[model samples]
Target: MSTVLTHVTDELQSIFDRARSVAVLTGAGISAESGVPTFRGGGDSEIWTWRGRPVTELSSAELIATDPQLVWEWFDYRRGMLTSVEPNAGHRALAEWERRFEDFTLVTQNIDDLHRAAGSLNVLELHGNIWRARCLRCASTFEARESPLEENPPRCLACNGPARPDVVLFGELLPDGVFERAEEAAARADLFFVIGTSAVVYPAAGLPITAKRRGARIIEVNPEMTDISFIADVTLLGKAGELLPQFLKERG
Candidate 1:
């Protein structure tokens, strides 16, 4: 049983050729291809729970304050899981695009460090990185990549204070400056890519519209139809790991 291949349109190819400043927004779907389960997706129920408590409950600011050890333990388990996952083809393709374009910005909702691992330099992480920890006292941050980290609720080197995962927890606001930069990139882009996202989560969901309002062509790459799919100049329906590489090849 063979499925018909979806070919990239000549119009899309032409848009790629003309694009100089490119901005991309990626979501959990991209990392899901690399075996990291999305928050709303299924597979390993264990990833979402610890001792019967939901990760959603364990990963909040309130939880961090009440039970920092439990929160750190859950994050440590997740970090261990991510240790074995590597950047997929989609990540590699974006990294390549950054090198090819005059100005490239990769904005992601994922906490996974896979984009940086894949060699992307200019990335704006909407949700902070899972591999980094922020000091509750000093507000300083440092990379904490060691899996099953030596310290649960790792302490800050600067102030002997408790730290939490740098990720934007449930109910927490997106870090200052990150979203502003993303909006700037969106406004400046000649081409905007909405990749692997459901296009429902705002402020991030609003970026595609911002780019479009600024006259950037919106190209959506996703397996499912998203909330913003209606605005896409072209929608390439598929997994990003496959479609992004194919898009690059077609443009070449």
Candidate 2:
């Protein structure tokens, strides 16, 4: 991955200098750099397996409704693991980027709060945070700082009803008003960056494509080539932790 072509680098600098608003989209790869497991791929978490089958199937609304205890157990295990991990270089750099630019928008597909933990402000979470739970009856949110609840499938104290992790699960729609803001940011950005995402996931995937079509200069940073690589004006092929800091030093 030694091909850091000069012409592409120069174009990126030009875009950075002139762009009025910038939008960034991050995926599982960024958090993976911080040792957070990617649910579906090679870096998938070991805790997601139950009786030799992946517990990921339980991360849906139907499962939560039918077997709430199982769902809570899975989420509790994940949250415990998240508490031990720290934000990596990529997360730190993006946090710094948020400070440098005035009209910057960050949209992430990850459910972990690593971006916030890294000191990034005003981030839009396409998938809700794993550290939070929402009450179905009361429509209130609670943050869990400790480990799993003593009661499997914690209840909402207010309504004494069922509560589940705030994340958008399988066959569930994204939370109200998040995707709209992401779309608005993508459409309005003068510079759009697709970082660490495969560009295959929908709604979120469409943001970069929307930005590209709207005339924003697209810059992609990933260790491997992604679907959006072909459309990027500068495809910096490397890990986000390695490439982002270098890119900032050279062109931030």
Candidate 3:
């Protein structure tokens, strides 16, 4: 069962009141609430398999190069699964925060575009979006949202070369300059919200500590204790969808 949230204390309210600049980092946990299967799998922690191989193995630059068709097929199926998924309350709350704060940044580890769907304009996707594809030959990139794309391993619009999902694979580095932007935002924020992530994945995980070290207050929102929970200035334990809306309501 999800943990029940206690009362929103005066100290907690003060933290929100004192913040002028805010930055938020989100992960698969937030998207999972909207039915997106997480990288570590969802509620059951079952690894998604494709042709007897874990999907994680298939999600690599090497695999995409060796068998582009197989990679495309798997991603196409994944896209179809997310076609009807909608942004939930947690997503909307962040979007509202963006409008409320003059300097707000939303950095996410998810490839899902739910943050943008929820009307957050200042999102920096650390992982490239799943709905976008990159050209193999010319290295051009574009959005290709057609579920079960007309052509498996869809052709690049700029070049006839085959396309691959524009995501940061197991061994691939983050998209160019994305991490730097997130770092700058974290450093500049007066309040940093680490939501729905365990903060175990490095690089992305290190962002919270960066903000904390820079003298920003760190607020962690998750259902269970995480690796970085000890460092959080305020740790709100509950479902993000349930807690975030309540948080905004209390702040108002």
The reply for model 1, stretches above 4 Å from the true place, is 1-5, 41-48, 250-252
Flag clash pairs in model 1: none
> All candidates' TM-scores?
0.93, 0.90, 0.93
Each prediction's whole-model lDDT (CA):
0.86, 0.82, 0.85
Top lDDT prediction, candidate number? 1
RMSD of each: 3.3, 2.9, 2.7
| Superior candidate under lDDT, 1 versus 2 | 1
Rank ordering of all candidates by TM-score, starting from the highest = 3, 1, 2
TM-score of 2: 0.90
- Quote the lDDT for 63 in model 3: 89
On residues 1-252, what C-alpha lDDT tens digit does candidate 3 reach at each position? 222245456677677766888999998889888988875834753457877888887897788879988888888878898999999999998998888788899999999899999988888999889999999889999999998789988899997888899888888999899999999999998899899998788899989889989999888888776877888877788778887777566443
Taking all chains together, the TM-score of candidate 1 against the true structure is 0.93
lDDT of 3 at 43: 73
Worst 10 residues of 2 by lDDT: 1-10
Q: Mind giving the per-residue lDDT tens digits that candidate 1 earns over 22-136?
A: 9999998899889987666533532666789887898898888888888888888788889889999999999999998889899999999999999999889999999999999
